[model samples]
Target chain A: MGLTRTSLTAEIGRGANYTDKHDCVVALAGNPNVGKSTVFNALTGMHQHTGNWSGKTVGTAFGRYTYDERTYSVVDLPGTYSLLTHSKEEDAAKDFLVNETPHLTVVVSDAACLERNLNLVLQILEVTPKVLLCVNLIDEAKKRHIKIDIGKLKKHLGIPVIAITARSKKDIERLKEEITRATDNPSESAYTVQYDDEIEKAITTLREGGVGTRFEALRLLDGTPEAGGDSVPSGAADAVAALQIARTAAELSDEIAKALVKTAEFIAKEVVFVEKATDMRREKIDRVLTGRIFAYPVMLLLLLLIFWITIVGANYPSSFLSNLFSSFEMPICRFLQRLGVPQFFTEMLVFGMYRVLYWVVSVMLPPMAIFFPLFTLLEDVGYLPRIAYNLDRCFHKCSTCGKQALTMCMGFGCNAAGVVGCRIIDSPRERLIAILTNNFVPCNGRFPLLIAMTSMFFISADTAASSFWGAAFLAAIIIFSVMITLFVSSLLSKTLLRGVPSSFTLELPPYRRPQILSVLVRSLLDRTIFVLGRAVAVAAPAGIVIWLLANINVGDASLFAHLTDLLNPLGKIMGMDGVILLAFILGFPANETVIPIMMMGYMAEGTIKGYESLSALKTLLEANGWTWVTALTVVLFSLMHWPCSTTLWTIKKESGSLKWTAVAFLLPTVIGAITCILVNFVFGFTL
Target chain B: MISLSYTPMCALSPGECGTVSDITLGGAMRRRLQDIGLIPGTSVRCVGVSPLGDPRAYEIRGAVIALRNDDAEAVHITR
Candidate 1:
């Protein structure tokens, strides 16, 4: 395996094209985990971080590159297996290709694994012919001792083929030149798959019945109405009714699908010859990791380890950041005072608003920063698909596609991303189920709350020996929460969201090493900031209101204490104080602010309750009339509680129904309350 | 008695047949139905229904495709 010839970019000096209002549009299509992003960055001279995994490009990412004075807008379509839209990314790519109408579509194939990638290539060719075959990752392909006949592949594809290691820009210029040339002379040829006799017969029938176009003919054969499921015109429905009179529609759809798959398989066998099957080392390990017997326990243990690591890693940084940010308050207060702002306004803006903002950033950022990169590492290593595969059984039992596990995995980072990720689950019933249950997997905002409670209430000073132990404890709590979520979802499926699960074929993407630094930076900025920003935006105002309540005296005590007293009995029954309940209510907008508001409530209204040790924290709570039962209740309630407002808004948007959103909120709250009551009853602790 | 060459899939008048000619799928509607193996060339039959009659279930690909009557109207086929 030899490295390809390297070429240097001799910048052709020319004035930038100012008159061209619309730049040349190029679409970047590829298999997941190939270095398409690296190529995008290299070509564009932009530093959009790259990760070693699929699914990161949840939405089509667009960037610009200037070549020979002309700027080309490159859209990075999500990596897909086939253009069949088995998942959301595939659907997005197919739709973008058909509807967006980009000037040039660059389909990036992994040189090492061209056969699997070619499945998509052939499908895309059927849709449009203005395509460029970018044989990317030539370096990886070379290491495998495989050589591709570039000219042959190009001839086979009937399109321009460029061999590239996208990380290096050696042949990028040539590739760009080819793209420019291809755009100038757009190809109009389309590929067709040879169908089985039955499919040919059905296609002929459908076509003669009036489905004239190839793509339309194929879809009609598959049974998807040309319009979406929700918008079937009356005339079309009438036609389908008439068609059904001759042959069973469902059987015809299945036959066409089988034909398409058989055709693809035939093409694969003809074009690809495996030199030697994939190194059996990974396969042997996958046997255990994704095995029949050990898979479930292994998945549980692995998930537990992830949770444990996240919690332990997050604690020190959370506290350190909290203390450091809190220390800045005095200086900020003095500076604001020096500016001669009114006293109350100064307090509101600085201690109230600024303090909450600081709390949100300091507390939330560190955990997400640590958690996302580690998760990204697992993703890059290609464990997410296995997780999905293993969990598919559970999804199937619930009458949903197994791919919903991917969305559930995304939920751990942020529910908004998870909601967006739901586009991957092809079945509407399953997708909606995934969407509604997404909040059950706590997002970055809620992680701190869970971690803080676990650290404060569960861990004793003697137990707080190492980060590993803390992480283990956190993992246990998370595992418990997930189990509860799964239980609730199961119940929902059986009762409210009941139906037989739809069938779907899920493709397991290969493992790759996640690009560490890029994942960290992007997730921290994109996920952490987005969540924290929402939290801070809500926290600032909520903080002022809390501050005012603490300061403003009511009949006997401060307004804060008065309200807490009024709600204390019910809170006590739930094993929480009025202050804690208030914190949860206030934190509904964003969980990042809960700790800060709780601290502020404690600080201004009562004694200095912050502790340097876990035991000391426990002692403080115990002194405040808490018990082991109380601690347990708080953790359980937090696990099953309402999602943050952003998640709720996403639910409303995705479901397009206020009724479902309300159900999403109330269902969780009800579960939380019931669990708390049941725990209290079992423990025999009366508030 | 045999009647017309085609009948609408959405017509509450059941026990009809049609050949699917074309399909239109995009937006939320596409997302909702694509997961159920609703590709073209599948044989379909109108099955029995619930009381409300909004979602008319059609058996396709050895499974059920439950779509609202309005959605069923989009399929243009011929007997």
Candidate 2:
């Protein structure tokens, strides 16, 4: 395919133009959340768009760059570790590189940990010769005192090495210059280490079809199907059996194992070098973080501390903001009163709709603002890897890799992101297991629901002491969600995705003093705005519906009250009232607003004071009817119940199977109801 | 069985374990396995199977590696 000038500029539109004989296909690959998006944006500017790779839910981003009148189409393959076909991202990366044969493959590795990064680079080098290693994140690496010898690395690999800070334009420009100069199909260089003879013999025989021996050898080593595209198809098992006639299958497998070990040693010696000797600082920290005895406790303590900070710190700001917003409402209400506006319309518009919106922003924003930065702080400090390491055993018990824990943690932030994050699990079965169990961990949306329940039913918000105790009690409920996650993961592993867990070489990234100022700014703006945007979009219409439900009365009761009464029987069985059930049903758009809407319903006629503390909240709930049993049931249900509609939509988008999305919706709800019913039966509420 | 934990049992699928076998894997396939310490003579063990019945998980030293059964079929193991 000669590079004909298709006037692709017109096709691709104003952002990029195509010139003749570009003859270069550069594949952008990296680890997830490593500023891959930032790099892509900088390189392609406004010309980038996302598309599916034929059938997969995995989105492939492709962009065009023009330099000196030549156009290069850059395919930003999904961020993946190694191109093993276990996860969707890996499957996408392997398919693109093997089938598409990108003329220039740019493997972006985090410069902070070069050894682990080399694993992906080495895998690509084995497959193709036209690869330019882009050691991205030079800035991050420098912060951790990592100094890479780019020139030496280039000489060692016999390929162009570009040191780039992906977010920086100058670094990207330098990379583009190297890409422009690199060969499309360079002479293939072998980077394979010696394997044992039996494995070698099997590999040699597999390659009898004249498909390269290295491809067969590595496929055998990694055990992924799409490693060589269609070099071998599954339906040809008979042919494979016929080919292996000379050697027993067991013999062939043993040979590959030897090759794996020998290759690891050879590569480790050549590519990896530690500038400094092993030190006590990192080791001491790891002992505490990854210790068999201390690890889980430390993890719990850290979680509790984060939640405590979020609950306590959020209150003052939330109240201050609410008071500010409520003060404005009073003035507005008086003006409307002066204008001779009717009481009902004024209450519906200002109190019903506005108060709910204000509660959502006030109650939810502070926690998100405080918590995201703290979470990002841990991530920035590189403590997340240690978390993966600490939790590896637990993940292994679930027949998945330890990295799946990271995805599970992401689920706490957002389930959809967690589902996408499962790319870290290289095994498809393991990845599926992670995705299925991810929703068991409650996201931030569910937190407000849990906290509101705790405050209303279990602890009073009238006093400061009660608020503090109530927040602690709610923190326990969040921890309970994690416990449930562990239990469900075990069940799924043994029953559905049964297997010995895949061993992963965990790199414990050394901790550094967090970039607090930068992390707070980026996470606050990026994550907070991103979440609030979703809430506003979905919750605005939901608020209007809620207003309508409370206002439009049929005979003696309004639509909301009527529905709540209808659901009362089932709700009472689970230690909650019909109103609580109806609120959850309507609050499917955003769980954070469930409490405010409930309050709107409770104080239908009278002007209600939004409780300033947890004790006062409990006094109000007690007046309405609440016991500790009700609080416990509500918290449990909130944690285990069906995810919001947005999360369900994301599940559909990520799984690409409406069947799985349906399963995702039903499975959690069933478990939630069963658990709550059992708890209520055993504990017998006194109300 | 002195059982040195670091030197994992050589119990991979017959095709994957070789006695110093000569092989070359180019492109993405090679690095995918290489990244996870699936280098030559790593003494990988095919300990279990995934439910989909394709990708198999292996134990290498103290770590575990999961790959597809098709990928496992490619590896030539030596006794």
Candidate 3:
């Protein structure tokens, strides 16, 4: 079946566009890690951060640039080695070429390894003649002592070839000029792959009969029936079916692929040269990083280092933001009161809505701001794929794609983004499995809760030891979440989405010196601000709801307490109280609001409350009869519970099925409930 | 020299190198293998194995790629 309209619209909606208007559409295609996005950003002046891993650009990103007083809208297609594969990225790049039929398709190639990259350029050349080969990363190639004869390459391919160092904005103006020329006057190159006799005959017949272009027919014969949509008359269908059956029987795809590879090799040899090849630094690094004995320890140390940095670095900014926002609460409240608003209205608006929003910002922003950049730095340094490589076997044991590890890493920033990142997994079933299990990883929003509870219960003393222990405990909880994620993924694949784990080319790209400024800007704007905006959007409505629930009473107790009473028994069985359960239910909008809601519930006040420190929060919890069991249970429950509403909405949009959305919701909630009950049972008996 | 015997890629020890002989798989897996420049006649070198000893990294066409033993087994190579 074709992609549903909803998903297509959602995918398009995620891309950057310029006011729904443009003079021309130019498509950017490239192999992963080839600086396609860098070129796009430089050309469009957009800040789409270049991720240094395969399939990181999992969706189309559009940007607009003005050339010769004409606005050219550039579509950055997902990086793919070849459009022949059935992966979502390949399909996205291929389908846009076929369906959207853009004015020009610019194929970006890495100058460091133009031979391997030429394979994709040849494939794109087959589909569309309106093509320009952009050999990017010339500086990197020069550093590696490789050279490309660009003039000879352009002559050999009979197409415009522009050499550029995307990082330095070198030759970008020439690129813009070339784009203007190529789009205005499309030219066909002499590049063509000569398949074996049988495939060639079949392609010729199909092309002559108007079934499709030779490239389209070859794609169909290469077992992509989805590519035959444009030529689907009854006669053409019969001819296509006969051709497919014959081709399958003959096993001609391999032969055709061999021919394409030969052509690419030939062209590469003609156009590219390597001089004084030095020892690859990446190999030496990989020997240590992915070595059998040191890999796990190194991975663990890195994880701890990131968390340690986040935990320590975030405190000052978090406290500063908290003090800053809290200081405004009184002034804002007084201002509202002075405006002749009633006390209750003022309290609801200021203390309830405003307080929760500020608290969420203060708590969630610092960690996310610190964590996402660190994560992106790792990604930019090409370390994330190694993490995926390290975890591939574990995920394979769970009968899911190893790419899920990368999505889980993204989930650490925001589960919604993780849910979207599931698109990187080509298989629908595995993508669903990734989406359903993503929330098992604690996001930045949940980090505050995990860190706070760990500090309050286990690391009671306000010492350096306490902070270290707190970070370690937080790390332990994260590891536990990962374990639960694997367990649930295994169970789901076996039961619901049954399949063996599929293999993908997990390209361990060469490590580059990360651009720190770009990493900071990208992590802050693309990740931190985006997620914080979402939290704030959901937190405001939740604030008013929490206020109403605490303020409105049935008889003697408020509705909040009544709901707490309803869930109190279940909460007790889970080693948590009713107010905590009520808080979780109300905190559905955003996880950062959960603790604030609980604090408000305990105070029995009509408004949310903020504490200056974890110790003060712990003191407040102690007043409400919290113990070690309660703290442990809350941490465990927070680790396992239903994903926040943002994640759920993302799930619904990604899965495009409420049934799966319901499954995604209930899967974690059920697991969380059961885990809490079991933890509480054992702790109750032991303590 | 064309070696008649083909060994699965998983048989290669870490740091061992081999040329791809044939891919005994079909559909997306086969296409993906080829897309990453792992076609027949291309040389692949086992660079390292993960701590778990299942998924191993191989250097192919100047790029390091990780493949599980299961997928590696489908790749017939000749040393």
Ranking by TM-score: 3, 1, 2
Q: For candidate 1, what is the DockQ-based docking class?
A: incorrect
Lowest summed lDDT over 10 consecutive residues: which window, candidate 1 chain A?
Answer: A1-10
Can you write out model 3's per-residue Cα lDDT over A1-687, one digit (the tens) per residue? 001122243366564353345569899999988989889878988777677877767667777888788988888888898877766788888888987788889999888778788889888878887889999888888888888898999887878889987777548988999999988877865577777776777776777666656667777677566644445534445566776676573377777777777787888788778785433687788878887778878887887788778878988998899889888988998898889999988988987888778878888888888988898899889888888888888898898988899999888878987887787787788889999999999987787788788877887668888777877787688788899999999999999999977766688888898989888987787767776777788888888888888888899998888999999998999999899999889989888778878988888877776666777888899999898989998998898888998889879988999999999889889988988899888888877
lDDT of each: 0.63, 0.62, 0.81
In Å, residue A482's CA in model 3 sits off its true spot by: 1.0
Highest DockQ model number: 3
Best by TM-score: 3
Model 3, residue A136: C-alpha shift (Å)? 1.1
Screening candidate 3 with a backbone cut-off below 3 angstroms (N, C-alpha, C), the clashing residue pairs are: none
Write down the TM-score of every candidate. Answer: 0.76, 0.72, 0.93
Q: What is the interface root-mean-square deviation of candidate 3? A: 1.5
Model 2, span A138-194: residue lDDT tens: 775665456777776776677788888865678888878888887433535535544
Q: Chain B TM-score in candidate 3, rounded to 2 decimals? A: 0.91
TM-score of 2: 0.72
Chain B TM (all candidates): 0.64, 0.58, 0.91
- The model with the greatest lDDT is 3
Off by over 4 Å in 3: A1-22, A227-250, A276-279, A460-465, B1-4
